[model samples]
Target: MRFSPVTQLSTRFDSVASDIAERLPDTTAGGPALAAGLGIGHVLVAGWNLTREINEFGAEMGPLMAFGLIGGAGLTVCVLAVRLFYSEFDSKQRWLVGWSAVGGATLFGAIVYISILVRLAEGRVIAEPIFVLSLASGMGAVAGVVVGELYATALQSAAVADRQRDQLEFMQSLFRHDVMNSLTVIQSRAEFLTQDTDGQNNRFAETILEYAQNIVGLADRVERMSDVITGRGEIETSPTELRPIVERQVTPLRKSHEEITFDVDVDEVTVVADSLLEEVVGNLVKNAVEHGYDGSDDFTVSVWTTSTGGRTQLHIADTGTGISEELRGEIFERGTSESGSGFGLFFVETMVDHYGGSVRVEANEPSGSVFVVELVTA
Candidate 1:
């Protein structure tokens, strides 16, 4: 399934944003600061109205004015505290804590300020300051709980996205792997049937076998191609000795290309990699035999390894026509190969990146292209 450019860009942007957000402080802090500020402002306005009323009609406006001043001062302190505390929160947990404290303090302060004004306006100035403070604190604590819940929800959402991506990759791998194995069996069976010597049956078997081989080949290509799409087929690192893997991957290619020569350099070079070493080596050798000498009768492709500074390098050098500088980068990109499907070196690049390895296409000192892979090992 291919996504449209717009969809791909959107998904890419979203992925980047989510990754950044995951590393950022919790957004819950924003909520508390906003809620607290609004709550406090409202409370202050209400208290101001009450204070004005007491000044206009009350016998003792002095105490009410004093109370209003204190309430206003408390609200100011809450605002400053929220700004200071929110700034200190550099991570999600700290943000949540900061917001909770700020929101609670602001809400409590605002409510108490409002309560004081309300009491003064309604001739309830005798009401104790502690009583008003308790009510405001309770409300602020409740609001803090809501902020905490929001943070939990955001964390849950991130977890869900991670799970979904894992499930999607798992499904793609299952289908692609099973299909390749099935095709391999079918191709093998068809080849076995082709060995019989009756003309009619042989011809029919041969044709069927040819198409079957094509289909099998197509399936193999599709499986390889799908790896990049599903992001499953990159270098997977493990303790690996190069000789056996190189030998096994290249053994099957030897029978058909008798005109092409094989040169094995190292006996037992060890390295760490996923299965990329096999794919990279196999493709280079195959490419050398098929296209290196422009379908010429005589050519040589070498499979060799070397070790330097805790890292082992695998070299696949061909005696084919050397690659032009213009095509070096493009050749490793998908749908850009001179051969079938142009995905060979694209897969190589993906594999190299997966193993934390590096690849460079340099002119073979004097002749063909040299494909080199460097891998770290213990």
Candidate 2:
């Protein structure tokens, strides 16, 4: 399936975010911090309230009674908050709540402390500093928990997206593997039939064999595409001469596509690439010959390479029906071709990316399209 560049970028970003999320601890895992922050806030508020009550109302009530009343009230509030909000959140979100609660409580305490100090310096009578601090801490804790829970919801959303992407990739891999295996079997049987047939049956067998071979070729392309998608293989780079590689690819293609005129104008330039460079060049040329011609032998495909600064540029231009402006941007993307199984340019792109090179399609002079690939010289 083909995705627009914007969609592709979004998917890639999500994948990366999911990876980072997986490595980090879950949101709810911040249990210790959450517990400590809430516990401390409750203690401060309860103690301060009880002390203030006694100072204002006298010691008619026992210390234990006053303590129980204040402490129990704070505990009840915390219990309710947990039941109403914290319990509703998932594990990943719970961690956000925990940390945010701590931060909120700390921030509240600082604000209250500074306010009380400023008021006292101004000679204004107000609640005791401890009492104010305690109240602030309690409020902050509640606010923090609420905010954290909200943040956790966002995290959960991201996690879900990641899982969906992973599932999709897994399904694609399975489908590719199964289909490739089936194609291989069909190709093998077709080859066997071709070997066993003669006369009239020979023509039928050859047709079957050819189609089966094409299917098998498509399967091979899919397999390579799977490898690229899954990042299963490493690109090994070595200094390689461009002229020989281009010649080797073009020579075989020329025989197969004799109708298309071939032109080579590359010099002997060495560049940093791997064995896959041949595959890259071959696919580009194949695409040109397969799609450029208009049922005539007058189409021309040119291959040329040049070195400038520290980079080498290889150009493959075709004198066939040119790609439309809309298609130019999508030619190198997977599954974007109108013919020839759509994997050719995709493979070229993957190989070019692996070599840290860049490939682009431009309008060829007079007509047709030109594919330019730039690679760093070794």
Candidate 3:
């Protein structure tokens, strides 16, 4: 898939954010809060020792220092919680509500608990309220910035995936249509040559050509699959005469398989389908010749057309080995074949699906197999 300039930047940014989120420490409610509180408590104890050493009359400083220590610890915990929530959430609204509730709860609980402590320590709670308000305001601003950065990073990642999908489709279409056609020509010519001989030299050449064709067909099938994976190749609509399409494919196939009789029964019915309807008919018909007959002496392939309910149905049936139920589902998938690259029916299916048409295989009455493609009347 081709990626745009912006896509590269977006991917890089996502990678960096993912790394940071994975490696950086998490701020759980209890852990960071408890740790910061302990740190603040230690600082308070150290300050109390320093104050006693500095002055003999410093008893009034005790409650004020204690208030500062606990309030500072609670605010630090609040900041850590905000950072953790922002990293976890990408939506602005989710972070907005989450941080507001969490920060408010922690901040208020700390203030209330500390107020009770100050009241009981023979000290006024007036100074403690000022300290609590300052801590909450500072932490809230830091939380806002963290949440904004996380949301911005998320937006960048979504844009990149979309662009990559487009590029993959374009590449698939170019390979499927253009390259597959060329390989089909080579396969056809090789088959014709293989039929025109009876000696060892001719048979060896034909065998080599047959294998070569199979390989080429396989490569073409892979190309088509690439398009399917990327969602790029789509069937286009065109008015196609069923008779001409069948005749064009039949003429060459008939030349290759002289022993096989083709009971062509198509009328001058036209159907709405892609121009590749010719290839679709060709593959089904060729499949019958190669795999259907099973060495039966009176082997025959038949092509006919019928109309019903404003739809044109084209049928290709063969008095040959029929498809087993086990492999039926995979017949239309690329790289499936009785003796070839298995891409023939897959290409046919792709074209049929594109033009809002349908194709199916069924056991022919009495014996053999029947393949049908139904299209909208042109």
Candidate 4:
């Protein structure tokens, strides 16, 4: 396939940068400070020459214009440094900052470029400025790459450390809570299945499959998390169909939960989300099933979808343990409760927010709670 000129340039730029990086020490072996010292040496020599030129021509011309243009050229790199080095650093970043240095170098190049049009435009020796600028470019590239690569390495190291810490905590949390629960459920269901053999015995089998499904889902999550951390997979989003998401998650639950009736009045609408949308729906439905009814009383859950303005709202109303006004917001936060680990709701809330959606819990008419999830309609 053919590529655009812009694409061609970018590819060329990356290839060149990668090749240069291969030659340089990937570690902080040669300090950028040494290169900076070389740069400083040239600056001092140029300053001395420019000083002599200004003094000799002191009677004829002013150094005001020269100082302004030259000073502006020198200051350009200082300004661009913040933007170029504040994030993750890798060898590729060295090239980016080096390019910025080249941009600053052009201001000096402009002096030479414009001088050809009018030699000694300010009665200064053209050769001296050209020589000085050439030295500056050569030394400046070495300094910029050295400094940027070192700084980028530092930033990248710190970021990697933090990410590793988070990944550790995440895995600990998964095993401590989610994975453990699945195991407990599986053990209990297996024992229960062997002992109970009645018309309702299939319910235990279905619940086992459901728990197995959850265990598989948890594994997928861990794998995806690893991919994101290692820069292998990205969170790509699209207009996900809500109807299928609701059906896929709820269908197995219906088989597992025969006692509780699921009144689904959903629309075939689409929302701005990713593959995680189904997980969000599944977690919420499971939350309702687990905590919806009192042991003695019967309860029902009603799910429906409605759109208004540009937002689509999914309502999961359950006549179960209704959230208190005080606990409404806190329920979604990552924590633990008597009935459940709060990670499921926390994951749901996090994913919904990532998709530019909002989820909130409110009191149902007389009893229980209503979870209203507002999503960007697509």
Winning model by TM-score: 2
* Residue-level error in angstroms, candidate 2, position 47: 28
lDDT of 3 by residue, 10-65 (tens): 67855664554455444334323333343344345445544553475455765456
Please say which candidate is ahead in TM-score: 1 or 4: 4
Ten contiguous residues minimizing lDDT sum, candidate 1: 88-97
Summarize candidate 2's per-residue lDDT along 1-378 as a digit string, tens digits: 999999897577446544544665765435434545475558666776677677877665564464564465346446634553446566545544555666677898899888888998999988555555766666676677666556556677767867876886798778877877877787788778879988888788788878877677656655565566557657678998899988988898888877778999998889999766777887888788878887766788899988899999999999889899999888878789878768778878878888888999999989899999999998
Off by over 4 Å in 3: 1-230, 233-235
Candidate 4 C-alpha lDDT tens digits along 148-256 = 5564565568678888977876776676587767677786776677566655776667667667767767777766655544445667779989998898878988898
- In order of appearance, the predictions have TM-scores of 0.45, 0.50, 0.45, 0.48
Candidate 1 pairs with clashing backbones: 236-274, 292-320
Clash totals in order: 2, 2, 4, 1
lDDT of 2: 0.74
Best-performing candidate as measured by lDDT: 2
Task: Flag regions of model 4 displaced more than 4 Å.
Answer: 1-11, 25-38, 59-61, 64-210, 217-265, 268-276, 283-304, 308-378
Tell me the tens digit of each residue's lDDT in model 1 across 1-378: 999999897577446545654766565455445445544654565466456656766748654664455455445435543653454333454344334545665677687788688878898745446435633654564455455445535656767767886886687679768876777787777677778556788787788778877676655655565665556565346887788888876677777666777787765766777544666667777776666775656567887888888877888888779888899878888899766898777777776776677877778866788888787764
Q: Would you give me the overall lDDT of model 1?
A: 0.65
The deviation in Å at residue 83 for candidate 2 is: 21
Show the colliding residue pairs in model 3. 292-320, 292-321, 336-342, 337-342
Model 2 clash pairs are: 27-95, 28-95
